[model samples]
Target: MPTPSLPHKPITVSIVSHGQLSLIQPLLGQLDRWCTDSIEKVVLTINIPETDLLGGMRWSFPVERIENPAPKGFGANHNAAFTRCATPWFLVLNPDIRLDGDVLAPLILQAGADSGLLTPRILEPGKSAPEAHRALITPVEILTRNRPGYAAPSVPSWIPGLFMLFRSATYAQIHGFDERFFMYGEDFDICARTQLAGWKLEVAEKLLARHEAQRASHASRRHLYWHVTSLLKVWTSRAFWRYVLQHGGR
Candidate 1:
């Protein structure tokens, strides 16, 4: 029998959880099957120390759970997650995202220097901001995603962090997500930085994934504050305009 082919390097998968015990349980369950022999390592960061629900789950791959008693910002947590990763490719996944099939293998094979950032067609339940994938982060977009049906732009520039596959080198060139963004805007900031550094973002229209966003901001006043604050943080920053001018965005 011919020798089986092995991956050049294993892909690292990570998810930061903040009290999404219920939602993540199923997500991980689906991931258990999907990851199988393909994944090298899986790290699940428990932001809520009290909730170690993921600790009990039976993971298929070499999964590790980190306990963060005093959880930091979203980017900081992921950046922390990245420290333990030694893979050529890394996937920053959201806790609310569910996998229907294999999204990593295909995306990795298609991604390279020309397109280091690969995003899948994020199918959100209902009219839940599918337009987020094909957009440039702007004040209007920030408002529209939360409100829905407000005419999002057709141009594609950024991808949602719900499922972003990054080449390790490209991610390092952009220096990963900005630690400043606590809960939001990190996704937009990273994409902008990637574009500024001359890496193209590609969307896999056929490679589909599902997003089950709770819209916690809309439900809770605190998250709403963070959402609005992060929007302002991304747009008002000097880097935002620098990227705009360099990348030809208004």
Candidate 2:
């Protein structure tokens, strides 16, 4: 086996594959073409082997494939990859997301003195600009944000997991995503934890990427179970109460 070279970039990129070779495969091509100089390593993790992850991968960095026999939850899958990541910063990217521009350079610059949780503006399937980044989750605000005419809060409360960049040390300190959350709320859970620990939750509004988001929770029973359970766990936690108090305008 020939050893592929790694990029000189400081970010370790990871993707948790639920056997979606069709989606992930194309994203790898996009990364290879658009962001060759921006990522140090690419780790593809899966619980099943429906497809060879590196079958046609031709990225600038080394591509790693790890398959776990047992069922792997979303957080657990990424946490497993994080163990092997060797970069100052790490990125969690969904297979359907396509990187088109110099996304990481801007994030790396914005993450300067403070390295918290950094994210970029994501262009959904069809929209003018990207959707607004939201405020922290709260019981009342949750209802309000969904109400007919409520306004989006000024600051970013949480970043979507579609493309999250974390400072390696900060992630280690927060202990990464709480695997307790099988999926869904883990994104908000980690960002909330980072904020409580005094790390800034940054949004690189100037940076851009495309997400062909598959909102599968409502489409499948297993995913729905993980979704609802994670919501219950996060909303009922003591940390959630603290978040509500500090950021809830209470």
Candidate 3:
């Protein structure tokens, strides 16, 4: 008789809503359609007070909703959700992200023993090129990033927070995202820390997910302030500099 295959480790998904139920509705629908078997549960954190729209909805996996009394930062919301994660894999997904098919199966299959974090190739809606596959950040690179003829590194040092799948152990090892990063820059910090802690970051090249970019920082003064301040914090962080030194960022 043939040997039986081992059961796959379940994944718990974490999604934070900043008053964007319209976007989460479609994302939840996609997850329901494509990820029934892979996802064990979803920990949904409502960072801001919003009308209860998801109470009436039913899903294949349990949906644990967290309604915060006040708004929390991006990292704080996800970190709170992470505390509720009971699965082997913990996924942090942006509200605006859309899934067309089973993205989790491929990523889980490709993750090696050393893989700490993994993300699918993220692309903007209606665009062919990938977005947010970024090089290591440095003071010089930040100054010249948008200048004429600046080249990005061949290998990515960090994946954005839009879609990050963390092994539960790795997430615990690194202590999760720095809650000090109110809105932005936590992704880079977490990626840097993960690598510094001897965990490998992997990307599934063929698997694709679409991001409907909100670009809120471009329009909102409060968001822009958060973005700028977070960048400063990241630049001065020990993990960022340590990663740069170890990896030889140009």
Deviation in Å, model 3, residue 154 alpha carbon: 2.4
TM-score of 2: 0.91
Cα-based TM-score, every candidate: 0.88, 0.91, 0.93
Candidate 2 regions with alpha-carbon error over 4 angstroms: 1-7, 139-147
Q: Compared to the true structure, candidate 1 yields what TM-score?
A: 0.88
lDDT of 2 at 4: 44
lDDT of 1 by residue, 32-150 (tens): 77756557777878887555565555777767778787978888888888888898878898989988887777776666558878888888788643545446677666567667466
Which pairs, if any, clash in model 2?
none
The true-structure Cα RMSD of candidate 1 reads: 3.2
Q: Which stretches of candidate 3 lie over 4 Å from their true place?
A: 1-9, 143-148
Which has the greatest lDDT? Answer: 3
Model 1, residue 238: C-alpha shift (Å): 2.7
Candidate with the greatest TM-score versus the true structure: 3
**For model 1, what is the error of residue 63's alpha carbon versus the real structure, in angstroms, after optimal superposition?**
1.4
Per-residue lDDT for 173-232 in model 2, tens only? 989989888888889888888888888988877788888989898799988998788889
In terms of lDDT, model 1 sits at 0.77
